[model samples]
Target: MAEGILRPLGSSDLRLSPLGLGCWQFSKGRGLVGKFWPVLEDSVIRDIVRTSWEGGINWFDTAEAYGGGQSEEMLADALSALGEAGRGAHVATKWWPIMRTAGNIGKTIDERLRRLKGWPIDLYQVHQPYSFSSAASEMHAMAKLVQQGRIKHVGVSNFTADKMAEADKALREHGLRLVSNQVKYSLLDRRIERNGIMEAAKELGVAIIAYSPLEQGILSGKFHSNPELVKQISGPRKWSSGFKPEALNRTRPLIDRLNELADKYGASPSQVSLNWLIHAHGETVFAIPGASKPHHAQENVNAMRFTLSQEEIGELAELADRSKR
Candidate 1:
């Protein structure tokens, strides 16, 4: 297991490897969001999962919105292929709340379980805060699932600080707690720090699962070195500000610092960035970097095999701070 220390996903009993595989790329090109990545063969997905498992990752994060449960199915199949299915590989998924009510938490759970091949949802989350009802209502529904043994933990994604507290309070009413909050956090986008999300998670004992910890490969420094590479990639990231010239120019210094640290540790820039993130807030922050290929999965697990000193972490943080100026 590479001596990778397992961290808690909040106060819950769930102990996860510092990094988990984000299954968005395994969506099978089935949904509006799934179109972001090309459909992969079953063998390819299995290989990625296999690499991650051998590298020490113990969990995965997928969503119902990702290919409308296709991601969940693919992930389960991959785990099963490796005999790592069942409770051995902890899996987390989110419920799509847009144009839906909290009632769907229970309403659609059967399909979710069926799609997952009955492997159990270790942590089931509400996908967003913009649902038809309040966060409290969503928590209540999630709590019911927990009580019914449908899910092991409750979490929320893309929620504001106040909204997270609201969900936590609702869970508390049932003698439960909101274990985690998944959000877009990375060296390139540290909005959670300025926006109170990280602080709130800490205060409430909620773990922050950082999705896009690589910032869609921006932190890899490849796109910055060769803008032409952007044309070959699919998805909205090519159109996002991070890939634009101005943003690239602004983030170059941070990327350079990542490379420097990478050389010192014999790691890739993505590894250094992922290392800094999981250690960014002690064990409070865990990251889910996606992988479309086996080597990408290998690089992600290699990220956990090393540690960044407080000085290097501080250096990267300072550079990121300056670049944002």
Candidate 2:
């Protein structure tokens, strides 16, 4: 596959690969949420990171809450192992907002910088909107970090449309802009489109950072073809309705369309799904798909090598809309 293209993230000077490597799985199953994934070997983690960097992925997204900050440390270690090769990679990590006031944003920013070995953070985000402090307060804190030169850009995740707008206004008060909103967006989950989030993002000029672009591998057509494989899934995915036989049956037509497109584009079903996202709304959308293995990273980068036709994109969108109804 050819090298992936980099694009501007919202109105920021920071450029990101159309596809980013998500480091949530690097937690190695250590934290409360990390227990859902099987422990991965350090060598495997390094390989995945190395592969992603070499495969043309320039940005990585991780969180402080992911495996209790282990994900940040592991990502740092993996990138450090690359020496000069990883120097230009942009790293985006989030601050967990649960049970904390806006003041905690600055306090935790120090810890996140420490855990990342003092590497510059390209985009620092509030992981979720469930905070004791108001959105305005939290964004003001994030804007402060940007002023301090700790984070290049400020972002948020899982924020509602109104809250996103409020956060943007708050950041503007500090002479900054909310660059992105990271949320779960995929062919299977299109809540952002129905809800006001997508519209707000476009109106506010904030990029939508799409996580789980493959719908936790459902769009890959793995569990649908082999129901037995669903038993081996760990974490919250095992309990997802998408893994159920009936749900799979209901989605068969959509999966079939994805597969058909995959064949036409000479790509995998997951690639087809991810490509759809990056091309969905011009440059307004980006995808961060996790790579548990080296080849997974390679496959993800390859997704950008080809572009889907407008007609093909429309057809897939129609299928997805019908499935939802």
Candidate 3:
């Protein structure tokens, strides 16, 4: 497939690849919740980064909480090895807002920068909405960082519709706009669509950064064809109902539809799943699928190589809705 296409990121001046490389797996399951997967070799990490960059992925998403900050360091190292070419890549990292006040937002900026090896954070976000500080105060803090040139854009993850609006209002108080809201959205998880988050984002002209666009690989149809692959899964997903035999059997209709569409488009089921997200609500949605290997990275970028028709999209949406829990 050809290189990925770039689209405007909400109201920001910045542009991003429709599909971004998620770096959560780079933590190799080390920090807090990092043990979901086994640790990977340094060589393997570098190759994944290189493959993602060469595959036309301009943005990478990571977090300070991931692998206890190891993920950020690994991402920085991988990009640093690319030298000048990597300079153009956009890095998005998040601040863990647990048991901390808004002041911590300012205090931790330098540390995040340090972990990223001084690379400018293109999009800095609050990993969650559990900070001791008010949403307004946190937005102001991030706005201040933007004004001070510590970060380029301010975003949040896992925020509700009202909370997201509040954050945008607070940023506007500082003459800034909330550019994106990172959330778990896929064919399997349509809560964002039912909840007010998706509508709020569109109403406010904010981008929806979709994490787990592949539904933790459940939508990839891998486990269905090879049930043995279920044992190879790590972390919470190993025991999640989505991977159970009955759930897999229940979701067969959706998987079969995805496979049928993939064959028609000459793409993989994973690619079809992701493409549906990119065109789901015009260009307001973007996906960040994790890539632990070079082939995974390449396959992710290929998702952008094709487009699904409105009829195909509607059919898939129906199938997904039926398969939802």
Output the lDDT of residue 276, model 2.
93
Q: Can you tell me which runs of candidate 1 are displaced by over 4 Å?
A: 1-3, 84-87
Displacement of residue 43 (Cα, Å) in model 3 is 1.5
Q: Rate the local accuracy (lDDT) of all candidates.
A: 0.91, 0.90, 0.90
Measured with C-alpha atoms, the lDDT of residue 300 in candidate 3 is 89
Q: List where candidate 3 sits over 4 angstroms from the true fold.
A: 1-3
**lDDT of model 2 at position 32:** 90
Tens digit per residue, CA lDDT, model 3, 14-33: 88999998998888678667
Indicate whether candidate 2 or candidate 3 has the larger lDDT.
3
Q: Let me know the TM-score candidate 1 reaches against the reference structure.
A: 0.97
- TM-scores for candidates 1 onward, in order: 0.97, 0.97, 0.97
> After best superposition, candidate 2 residue 233: deviation in angstroms?
2.1
List clash counts for every candidate, in order.
0, 0, 3
Residue-wise lDDT of candidate 2 within 1-325, one digit each (tens)?
Answer: 1256889999799988999988889988877988867778899999998888888898889999889889999999989988986798889999999999999998878789998996789999999999899999998888888888889999999999999999999999988899999999998898999999999999999999999898879999988788899999877878988788888888889999998988988999999999999998899999999988899998998898899988988888888888766
Off by over 4 Å in 2: 1-3
- Best first by lDDT, ranked: 1, 3, 2
